[model samples]
Target chain A: MKAKIYIKYKEGILDPQGKTVHNALESMDIKDISCVTIGKYIEMDFDNISKESAELITEDSCKKLLANPNTESYTFEIVD
Target chain B: MKAKIYIKYKEGILDPQGKTVHNALESMDIKDISCVTIGKYIEMDFDNISKESAELITEDSCKKLLANPNTESYTFEIVD
Candidate 1:
């Protein structure tokens, strides 16, 4: 199975990077854009693992390293 | 409309961050993993634009700011 993970800052956390990009876009004349948020997208290939195992591994990895629990939230899905 | 952009290093380009994370996962004894890739996931909110305009804006933004065409490739979709 393959796993796709998305990690983003939790709501209420200030995202300076996002704000900077928003300003950059404005300066570039890319208007009508109200917000710009950036996050991490991770794709993992597993060696013939069951979906259940992949989910377990993905969750563990997210908690242990992929995301900072206090500030970031993550979601993952396992696919063929 | 909202634009969802996913940008990643081209297939031949080296992804040091992904490699480092893979190695870290290995050291943590998370096995059955063949490969890992890390990419940028950007979400942009546009102010009441038509679908056609959204597409054009998204494409332009990807080319002008969101992606480095020389070493990175991107795909985006306009979502409701």
Candidate 2:
């Protein structure tokens, strides 16, 4: 089985990198570009695991390894 | 309309944050967790834009504002 995890910064957090990119875009004459936020993606492939097992593994992964849970949020989908 | 953008680290890039999380997981007695990589998600909502126009806007937003296009890659989908 395979799972894809996406993690990103919280909406209200200050993202300096994103701000820099937004400024660069304005300098490049791109109009109406409001904002940008950055985060992470992880793809995991496991063998010999049932769907329920994968869900448990993924939940643990998110809590312990994948997301900070303080400043970031994560979502994942299992693939057949 | 709304667009969801996902950006992530390249496969080969070294993610120290991910590694740190992995190590923490190990210390917490979680096994079989091989590796972790992190990335970002950006959701944008725009008013008064056609789908084609949104595509163009998004492509330009990605190139100039949304993605670095060097160490990161991005994908965006338009929502009704």
Candidate 3:
């Protein structure tokens, strides 16, 4: 199975990377842009583990290091 | 509109970050995990531009900077 974690900056939080990307887009004359944000997408493959276990582990990873609790939020899914 | 660009390492590419995460998962006793891969997710907001133009700009951005043609692959979507 493969597990995917999606992490993104919390709403209302200032995102410098996103700002940079937005500015870059503007410079390219790709105007009309409003805001930009950046995030992380992580995929983990596993087998033989209970789905419950995978969920727990993914939750742990997201809460521990995969995201900064203060500024980032994450969600995950498991797939066969 | 909002554009999302998802960038991931090409298949068979070595990913130290994924390896590290895998090792960490193991250490946490969250075994059963086979492999891990990390990626970037970027969101760009825009207005007034035709979806066609937005698509072109997003493609150009991905080809130019959002992804490395050699080791990374990217896909994007525009949303309201």
Angstrom error of the Cα, residue B27, model 1: value is: 1.1
Residue A16 in candidate 1, Cα distance off native in Å: 1.3
Model 1 pairs whose backbones collide = none
Count of backbone collisions within predicted model 2: 7
> What is the full ranking by TM-score, best candidate first?
1, 3, 2
Question: Which runs in model 3 stand beyond 4 Å of their true positions?
Answer: none
Q: Write the per-residue lDDT of candidate 1 for residues A1-80, one digit (tens) a residue.
A: 89989888888888888899899888999888898889998999999888999999999899999999999998888999
* Better model by DockQ: candidate 1 vs candidate 3: 1
Model 3 chain A weakest lDDT span, ten residues long: A25-34
User: What's the CA error at residue A65 for candidate 3, in Å?
Assistant: 2.4
C-alpha displacement of A77 in model 2, angstroms? 1.2
Q: Provide DockQ values for all models, in the order shown.
A: 0.84, 0.45, 0.71
Considering lDDT, which of the candidate structures 1 and 3 is the better prediction for this target?
Answer: 1
- Give the alpha carbon lDDT tens digit for every residue of B1-80 in model 2: 76678777776877787677667767887656566555667765556778777777778888875667778888889887
Chain B of candidate 1 achieves a TM-score of: 0.96
* Per-prediction TM-score to the true structure, in the order listed: 0.94, 0.74, 0.88
Candidate by candidate, in order, the iRMS in Å equals: 0.9, 2.8, 1.6
Residue pairs whose backbone atoms clash in candidate 3:
none
Which candidate number would show the highest DockQ if scored against the true structure? 1
* Models ranked on lDDT: 1, 3, 2
